[model samples]
Target: MPLPLPPLFAAWRQSLRAGYAWKSLRGDLSAGLTVGIIAIPLAMALAIAVGVAPQHGLYTVLVAAPLIALCGGSRFNVSGPTAAFVVILLPITQQFGLGGLLLCTLMAGLILIALGLLRAGRLIEFIPYPVTLGFTAGIGIVIATLQLKDLFGLSLAAQPHNYVEQLSLLLHSLPSLQVGDSLVAVVCLAVLVLWPRWVPRVPGHLAALAVGAGLALLLERAGLPVATLGERFSYHLDGIEYPGIPPFLPSLAWPWQLSGADGQPLQLSFELIRQLLAPAFAIAMLGAIESLLCAVVADGMTGSKHDPNGELIGQGIGNLVAPFFGGITATAAIARSAANVRAGACSPLAAIIHAGVVLIAILYLAPLFSYLPMAALAALLLIVAWNMSEARHVQHTLRIAPRSDVLVLLTCLILTVLFDMVLAVGVGLLLAAGLFIKRMSDLTDTAALPKHFHHALSDLPEHVLVYAIRGPLFFGAAEKALSVLRRLSPGVQVVIVDISAVPLLDMTALAALANVLRDYRAQGVGLVLSGPTAQVRLQLRRAGIQRVDGQLAYVRDLPQARVKALRWAGGSKT
Candidate 1:
């Protein structure tokens, strides 16, 4: 089918046409403000975690939230840079620089848009459940590892891209930890952990960040070592200085205009495009999977069915356009989406209002937010990573799951932490698929020929034999079915294969069947195939397997097959 534009968002349209009352408007406004407040610190934290400026995170939120609200399928879903992308985005950023990262994001956006339009959005479900859990948990561990340096103020000579190497570097720099910075982190982490229990009025994360910032400022005034965003960002990112905020609104800019950390100009060429293709594809798949998963969670909470394809288009467009303003890959954040629902959001209007809140903060409160300590942000991300890891779930899975499933889950986890996410996901999916195939083939069974159904061949000698094939005749099960036929008795004169229970036959299975027929013909035994389905019969006919040399014939049923086999044995069908 040809690709089509995603259908209009009827949910949003309906809300406008219906009598949306002020009661609902108040709920949406309150929800929007609540989501926006929590999002401010998270957006900053996630951006830093991804090794980018805090503004980039806010920029993504500011642009993507509104775009998604206007075009998204889910009313409550909040889309932006999420914790899940931190590991995946880092490698691309290091290899390609900011320009290449943005370009890669744009390409990913285009790919996602194409997938949504093609209605291939449903393919995300095919990713095995274990694979999703493994990689997600693996990512959580990686996120926690990445934050340790900031959490303890352990500045390494360079941050290694590989997890093992990074861990080693972190270990070596352990002696370099500053107590002042550690205390700041402790304050923030404690606030985040205890605030919910003690004081539920203000968002715990925000309160934690504020306390951490105050302590850092006091440490700075007392001449103690404490790193702040102001100290860190003023000299970061290929000479683009930042102390507070850019103070400039987002505007159109070519991604290739930026340079690498080493000052190498990023040239947009076929070679660069080729280099980023794999990363771009990773971004697209991850974004689509995350967004849809968030939408599903929102649906469960709100009893609303979101248009998956429409939401995909909204996500795609957001990622595609946000890059032009120096934003990274954007997608629906599950935690934030869930929060939007819990905050009493009634419609997409809440998301739009949330975006407006972020825009206002960026314009007015950027300087104040810049006072937030990196240590606090690190603590916040550590908490997020802990939640995302789902360690309890993973532990439970490792215990109760089948050995093969455990193997797959562990393989994906090990690969993600020990290597690149691209390799991890690719190998995880392949391993899961192989395991599925093995299980399918195991279910395929063959049984002895039934005598009651062989009454039509009563006149035949007792040496005549029958065999029944069960389950799908796809590649996975074909060899098992053929193995059974190989064990036939030596005195067999006619072989009747009952395929009445078989529903499918691919080329490989057809070839296997042809091989069985050839072996039987060589041994001077007649072969009869019973009950080829319409689709299977079409394939067999196309393969020229119809009655040939009085040995092979496609019969309607077991009785017909018996009669055909007897006739073939008498050399009548020839």
Candidate 2:
């Protein structure tokens, strides 16, 4: 049902052609280590933001990063869990739990794989830039709002589904804030913000995470009020009280074993799987956009070209496999990719090594992760949301873009925040397509020939009239163009349509032309066509429309149409 992978795997192809040297290998190693450290906290943070265990994020990185590097076309793209998936994944988890997420991811992976095999990577650009901007801004706002409870260490008894309700709940619970938790969250937030600027060589999130974990331990030991991951999830390993995270390797997990929040067992029914299709499609679309955009940014930064279709296939394989290994959705993370490029990464080896390095950290450091404050993770998410909002881009678009485009942007933003990504994108695309059609229609025009052009004809005959059509004679503009025929002079005997400027025509345009021709035939006027381009010529001939008053004649140029019209008008005898 699907095509095979390209002739050669992208990473191997690059290695063969680019001459992977020891010098490049050295650069790849350095960049890989830097990005690996940088990627660690982000992976954990993104998973938590989506209401999953921190380890799920790490699982995604361990599984997806290396696979994408091996199969993907972009040498520098860093694939893993990202903030962009949070909005889409949150509702799915809340509704259907982890099982639904796994199944949805699997379905999305299949779709992406098909897209790549079909070489449809270039179709991703069809989404309007304004629509993406609007929805991304909306997701950012939603993410920030969702984190408010953790940001303030408020004891919200239950999380609300909608943004406004979540904010209301946060405000209501603010008085119940834990002082130590609040303080630790603020300190971690500050470190995450300033650490990169202060220590340029080290990854800031890891530093902030350490700061939060240390403060959390201090508060817990001192018997102050704080909520560590240990307090929420208790576990035992080797007769020790492991705080939160489970020590793990890449191991297969069954998707059907998922349970609901109320601890109800999962059922693999047809209706349930059918309901997930929309969300799965949304995930696929978001993944494609995020990954391709990351690759584009990588290309620009490194002055390297990436095969988008190959990259999509690679991402498909990563997502398709990760869910079985206790992981969630993933894509090419833009920040890490940019970091890899800046750190002198020469190939996908950097990304592969990054995955390996994170795996090593998982073996050694994951045990201590349970002592980290949940509020600290929430703080990291706040910074991520801030970056994703792109407030500067929104402000600039509003100031400079056309009013119609602004409307699309605002509509998409509102819909996304109030509804979901799928609905927002659907409505936004509809608006864009409608606007495009209207603009095209506006460009097409029809006009009767002015008096000065009569001399170019074989002989000036009063009953032979000419009309010129300009711009694309497609469905959108066809009706308007044909309406000009209604203004034909009463004594006109032959109608000559000069289609020299018409680039192409569709079925709707042909139907409209047929209607106009029938109306002219009712008035005893014959029609002569002129100067159809090769494609349009085929379409007109296939239409097989015959003139009722006289035989329909197709001409090579305007003068030939003039001669045909003269014959129809009895001009040779004159």
Candidate 3:
């Protein structure tokens, strides 16, 4: 057999076929510049949130954005290091360092590629809404909480891994809050909240960060030092050191060659790969969900369709290539993608140009970025967390949603906050699946058919009983729906079961039916299966439930079944 064609660059090809005009290119340029300005502060802040140098985040956008745009299935999706990754990436960085984190990203990229090749992108839709909401809310809470140290300028001896412990540490260190940092954070936050209303044309984040950086510089001159990016982070080149981010393009290098948790080279081994497998899978799953959801949102905004599998492959390629360029796990940022659409993005060229904007910032504006206050970045992330949590939506859902859905939501939320996303998602899916099965089973029912419903059934022999089975006969519902057959009275000479309404019959249902047949044979009663749909009939015969002398019989409809039952009753030994 010939191999199937790969779903590569599907969106790019589609947009090309649609014909790009100069007008479209102009729109793309405008959108790219707009979103690029928005992404700069966000990327740095997310990298800081993940316990890495801010440059790595910029590197992610520099590499991943253009690659995803060139190869992905969504024309307007802007891929980058997003706030959603902080909860997962922070722990990895703490435990494994940059090298381990990058290696994990590489593994996740491969997994995503495999998922795309298997055509599993559409499966993301099966995840229940409550599950997504709960985990996101939990993640938002975690991200917001982690930013508190910087937001308050609290000095910590060490950061703990557990959420409760982290909270305790933050509370204990609250007395050490630097007034200068608090002032910077408050001013930056005010600007972020109000700038959009004051100047609707300009992005709030850029203005807020600019104001915060200026405030931090003034505070330092006033003998009240608030920590800035240049003060907290530095990089070495040749022999001299550069403050904040490095002003250069990302160079190629192996992920495993970077520093580990102990500030030494990470040892790449089978055991290490095994250890990272679970986290890698988690990254891949989350990336797939985030990217596909973003693509769907873009589709709704632009009235355009997306090729989901092609998008997955493109994301996989971006992630796979990014680690070598000092990038971390990246996905389509929803807010950025929304901003792209609102800024008049017309094609993948906009995303490609967004990458160009980031590249320009790295080369020209890198030194100035060092002046951005940590508190300002923290303040920015606080807003991100607020938007991400969707607290109002969660409240509405709790009020109006079914109790089972509420339970799933709360369970996922609590688990995610306390433990991790992997456990939360796994348990939530299993719980949802079990609840769904119970609900489906409740809908399947078997009951005696009333003779008055059909004129031909009205004169049926008193010794013959006809029952109708409805709904799919899957495992959960099979035994309960078919158990009625075992309760037939001893005086009953023949039982006609009408199953035309049944839409499916699984192995469990077949087994349940076989048990029913055996019980009827033992009771010396004839069984007539009537009105079975073609599928049900095939299942019945395949399970060896064929016509037997005076034991079992099959008929096409209720009328034929009535005749069969009457004839059986007449000749029955009972």
**Each prediction's Cα lDDT score?**
0.83, 0.84, 0.91
Sort every candidate by TM-score, greatest first: 3, 2, 1
Q: Name the 10 consecutive residues with the lowest summed lDDT in model 2.
A: 545-554
* Model 3 residue 17 distance off true place after TM-score fit, in angstroms: 2.3
Model 3 C-alpha lDDT per residue in residues 20-134, reported as the tens digit of each score: 9998899999999999999999999999999999999999999988998988899989999988888888899999999999999999999999999999999999999999999
Q: After the best TM-score superposition of candidate 2, give how far the Cα of residue 402 lies from its true spot, in angstroms.
A: 1.3
Worst 10 contiguous positions by lDDT, candidate 1: 565-574
Comparing 1 with 2 on TM-score, the higher-scoring candidate is: 2
Backbone clash pairs in model 2 (N, Cα, C under 3 Å; residues 3+ apart or in different chains), count = 0
Cα-based lDDT at residue 149, candidate 2: 74
Model 2 bad stretches (over 4 Å): 1-8, 217-224, 236-241, 453-459, 546-549, 572-574
Best by lDDT: 3
Give a tens-digit lDDT track for model 2, residues 1-574: 8756562267557655888889899989999999999888788878878877778888888998888888877888999998888989999999888788887888888888878888888999898999999999988888888877776678888878987787788888989988888888899889988888899888888888888888887887788767766666655668987677776685687765766544676787899889888898899899999999999998899777888898888889899999988789989988899999889899998998999888988889876777778788888888888889899999999999998899999999999888887888899999989999998889889888765866765355778777889999888899889888767887888878888899989888899888887777677787888888888888887888634534665677877677667767777742
Candidate 1, position 284, lDDT? 90
Return whichever of 2 and 3 wins on TM-score. 3
